[model samples]
Target: MADEVQHLTRAFSGLGGLGVDEPAMVSALARWRGQPEKRSGFRKGFPGFFSSHGEMERCEEEYMLRLAAEFARLKNLVVLWAMHPWERDARLAHHVLHQHHPAAIVVEVACTRSADELLGARRAYQALYHHSLEEDVAYRARDKPYCNLLVGLVSAYRYEGPRVNEEAARAEAEALGAAVKSAAGGKLLAENGDVVRILSTRSKPHLVETLRRYKEIHGRRLEEDLSGRGREETTTLLLEAVLCLTAPAKYFSQVMEVALREGADEHEKDALTRVAVTRSEHDMDEIRAAYEEQFGAKLEDAIAARAHGHYRDALLSLVMGAHHHHQ
Candidate 1:
């Protein structure tokens, strides 16, 4: 572990000079891909090896100035991968909160993480930014429905147990159905307190049961009902939250498909890297299966087609398991 940390430190410091050694950095990152403990150790030891503050940020800024735009994506991926997952997510949430239509990213972080993971991210957010995740989210999402929904989600500490009350699930499903029915041609479901409460509070299994009951009771998926109202921002955010919380693999697979599609813009393509980096260790296999089941082609082959050079290599290394070799 000590040798590996030293090797990573050398590889990172070597990123500077006349030109960046992109493969060296990729190789170093690949070594730690599925090894979360080693990655954590490296993050802890990194500062001891380098006197600089924000070494990853400095590397990223240098790459931006010295390398082409495509290389910038690779650098971003490295920076994200190298951080502790908690800090990585907190930073991701912070970065996206400033972007246009950031609800999807916020919803992704708030919904997909496990209870402990979400709590860790919130704690990291407070430690890193000196403010609460919910506080920042509420302030940034100052509009109605979005502010309400996002704040509720970030503030949630959902029950992770297997217990599901059938009566409660059915009643909530009925409330959701009624909310959607009443919301037609007027304010969407995001404005409904019951919708927000049920989504933000229920356990994953409970929500799955509720949504299943919703389909049984309503004769269609809840997303279909929401989509029928058109793609208004609040409705879309609500839809995103539902899909993210209930069907994360499917949600991530859809995100990858759009990101790898032809003529995808930079913002769209960014999702490819984010999903690949974040999910690779956790559930890449499930996401890959979901992608193949949905798109009729392998997720890896699609990534190879869209991404190029070192950027492509890094992404593939992540999507495929990274080799354990160093240098």
Candidate 2:
């Protein structure tokens, strides 16, 4: 059943031969360079933003989809110029291309739902251009902390193409759990780190079963193992993200409430909205409470100030805070 819709779905910095002066794009970069800059709020998980469950409907209309379209068109252009792979300098140049073409980068990231397609577009760009896409990314991402994030996105720890129940996830999780419980506790092999490298697939059923089986075998839970590792925050995030890998709804209450209470502005509200739109498909009641505790305010009240109509109503419906369970 998961096979039906293959979900859809970063960079470095360097300078030189970026071709920032390429045609109409040169003018666009100049304008953006001229505008006042804004920070990436929340890093961007505003505190008290998610709850146990999440809002699910995409409210397709609500998303600025057209922006993504523009990015797609521009990314293709960058790829065209990248035919000759260069070193770090050229990679930074690629992002300069993105910064040069803000719309393209925004659009590409927003519309990109999967790492596979993202990598595909990247490879296509590399194949056409002489340089590897990674170089272009690194070059453009220079100095910005988000650079690592852009690069981190290069590969997926999860599987792609199909949600085949090869039990691949089960085996991997069990192996990881076993390793963690034995002599390998808190020890990651040189090879394992990226989600693309670890569990190997983002497919749902397979992952759930994997975690579940891991618990049965190891006595300790997957979350427990994850939280026990070094880099406490990263560990929590890793576990949470994995849980979200299959059940994004579970964290909605925490994400939304954080946004609304701490949001204090449209940007914050928009951030919460962004989180909710994606998670709405999951349970939301748990999310609401988490929000309340995290932000000391109800998620509904926060959104009430700015939202209206179907998109607003749909989210409210979820946050009505009922613990709706799936049959």
Q: Pick the candidate with the highest TM-score.
A: 1
Per-residue lDDT of candidate 1, residues 21-108 (tens digit): 4665577678778888776566566543323455341224544353454557778889899999999999889888766545688899
lDDT: worst 10-residue window of model 1: 12-21
Runs in model 2 with CA error above 4 Å? 1-154, 157-167, 182-196, 200-202, 230-233, 260-270, 277-327
* Candidate 2, residue 209: lDDT: 70
TM-scores of the candidates are: 0.78, 0.41
What is the TM-score of candidate 2? 0.41
True lDDT of residue 298, candidate 2: 64
Error of 2 at 52 (Å): 47
lDDT of 2: 0.44
Q: Residue by residue across 121-166, what tens digits does model 2's lDDT show?
A: 5665575567656566556656643344345444343344455555
